[model samples]
Target: MARYKNALTKYYVGDLEEKEANLRLAKWIQAVEDDTDEEVEEEAYYDGDGTPEEDVISVKKKYSFEGFYDNDDPAHRFIADLEFEVGEDRKIWFKQERTSGEILEGPATVTEPKVTGGEASEYQHFSFAIAWDRKPDISKSDDDAGGGVEG
Candidate 1:
């Protein structure tokens, strides 16, 4: 088995069309979390076993990110500006690159960053949530095109 370090993961934000050229790295990030949820419905039949069956009707994928605040970073700036955009159409492209070289890209709606905590000596930190507009695209890295491998 192969092991990968979380420190090597990269995150970016920008327009999807010019993703390669325009994407800005989310710098000084401390943590990235997956916040996916599912909605299910239960169905019970009159002439069947006593156990009820549950089916997943829908799924919602999201990410919760936490990091030190940096005013100079374009990605951070973009997230901060989202606070002012109140409409449902407010969305931006995001990409995640795993250490194993798999890429996850999509458009997502971001909530305004909220201050996680503050202290007299500690650096200011913030956290925000990102909800995917739809299912994201996942692709394997060029190096892994031929075979399946776990990182």
Candidate 2:
């Protein structure tokens, strides 16, 4: 079960690599190194109710992948990073990256994007579950000058 930390992790800033975005996270952000190859530690700010406030605007996560193209590419582009958008309100997209070339062969296609600017990417990711929200009662707030019998 994924924990909705009420805010984005300091590990992400729009779409930036961990190294490129660490500075952007600032003190409010939190991060840690994991013994495993996979990223282990991540931090996010919180509001009074354990939710991200206006000061916290991002709802995204960035993941990285680096391995040989294995397929055939001689240079063997590195799968730099994968970015994931927080929340399930919309479709999530991952940006593909290559450490050596602007475009590299992926699986059977060569359409994946490469690392550029500071745009973190998402080649792999999962969406946040959307839960039902409670409805508000506004009948009393409605202004009804006319009675049940209207001309």
Maximum-TM-score candidate: 1
Work out the TM-score per prediction. 0.78, 0.16
Q: Candidate 1: global Cα-lDDT?
A: 0.73
* Candidate 1 C-alpha lDDT tens digits along 1-151: 5666565667777754554414454677788888888899998888878678899998788888888888777777777777667765457787777766688888777875664468879887878888777887898877654223335
Candidate 2 similarity to native, TM-score: 0.16
| Cα deviation of 49, candidate 2, in Å | 20
lDDT of 2 by residue, 1-151 (tens): 2232322222212212221211121222122222122223334465355554334333223233222122222122122222222333222222222221122111111123333333256222212111112111112213223222222
What C-alpha lDDT values do all the predictions have?
0.73, 0.23
**Pairs of colliding residues, candidate 2:** 6-52, 15-119, 15-120, 16-120, 82-121, 83-121, 83-122, 94-122, 95-121, 95-122
Clash total of candidate 1:
0
Off by over 4 Å in 1: 16-26, 46-48, 115-117, 145-151
Task: Report how far off residue 140 is in candidate 2 (Å).
Answer: 41
